[model samples]
Target: MTKLAEMQCEACQVGAPQVSDEELANLIKMIPDWAVVVRDGVMQLERVFKFKNFKLAMAFTNALADLAETDFHHPGILTEWGKVTVTWWSHSVKGLHQNDFIMAAKTDELLISGK
Candidate 1:
């Protein structure tokens, strides 16, 4: 089976179908560390990675920023002194998508690669 991080994000249109219950269940397994959240009534995927120092945190953030630009799907990223919180959701679809899960997995991949 193709991993979530290995799946490329397709262009999500305004009326694209969000990941359904079954899909969410499967994708959730692919990215177990991510927490499903509802903010302003829209579903999202979030995870926070702990770091030992500010420099490492910023490095991860910068890497994610570049990845977001490359993927054309940006995320809500907060880089703090010892942690980076990443929130991924499809603003166009007004909820989570397969892309969100894919990006979330990719984020984790980047974190591990950086270490």
Candidate 2:
């Protein structure tokens, strides 16, 4: 299997299946900073990226949006003065998908690449 960051997201349409518990556990290991959480009783993944100022925070958010567009999977992003909290889940399936973890890895790549 491709590394999560090296993979592209597959669409999570209404009938799509969420990732298996085994799969999610393995993938989450690749992005340890991310937390598996329940929101509205649906499982999701979240992580907060910190920055020195609002400008850098917004820059990260924009880069993340661009990445999401490429993958056709967007996350819920909260841009604050010095941090951006990103939440990823499959809205249609209402749970976690491989795409969510893949995008989470890509999000970390954004910070590492400093783009």
Candidate 3:
């Protein structure tokens, strides 16, 4: 089977479920680094963007914002000295929908492109 098939099957095994608060929290703990637990009890996939300085971080943030706007899906972003934390969750579902994973993969692509 293809990778997509595998992922889909795996998701289905979990009932194609939207992650519960407890489950999401456990998953985040299992997958450390560049991820956090959100205040709304959702999964927040974060990445620490190390830029040369604050200026670069701001520029990246702007570009990232544009992408999010175009997708019509937004994430919670926290900008600091040289890092940006991005968190994604489906507010409508009040949990983690498949769209969250798709966005997370796209977000990973964005980060990979930067490298």
lDDT of each: 0.93, 0.90, 0.61
How many clashes in each structure? 0, 0, 0
TM-score, candidate number 3: 0.64
TM-score of each: 0.96, 0.95, 0.64
Report the C-alpha lDDT of model 2 over 5-54, residue by residue, as the tens digit: 99877756897998898998798899999999997899999999999999
Candidate 2 — worst ten consecutive residues by lDDT sum? 6-15
lDDT of 1 by residue, 4-38 (tens): 78899999999999999999999899898999999
The RMSD (Cα, Å) of candidate 1 is 1.0
Instruction: Highest TM-score: give the candidate number.
Output: 1
lDDT of 2: 0.90
Candidate 1, lDDT over the whole model: 0.93
Give candidate 2 regions above 4 Å deviation: none
**Least accurate stretch of 10 residues (summed lDDT) in model 3?**
1-10
RMSD of 3: 5.8
Q: Which stretches of candidate 1 lie over 4 Å from their true place?
A: none
Residue pairs in steric clash, candidate 1? none
Candidate 3: lDDT of 19? 66
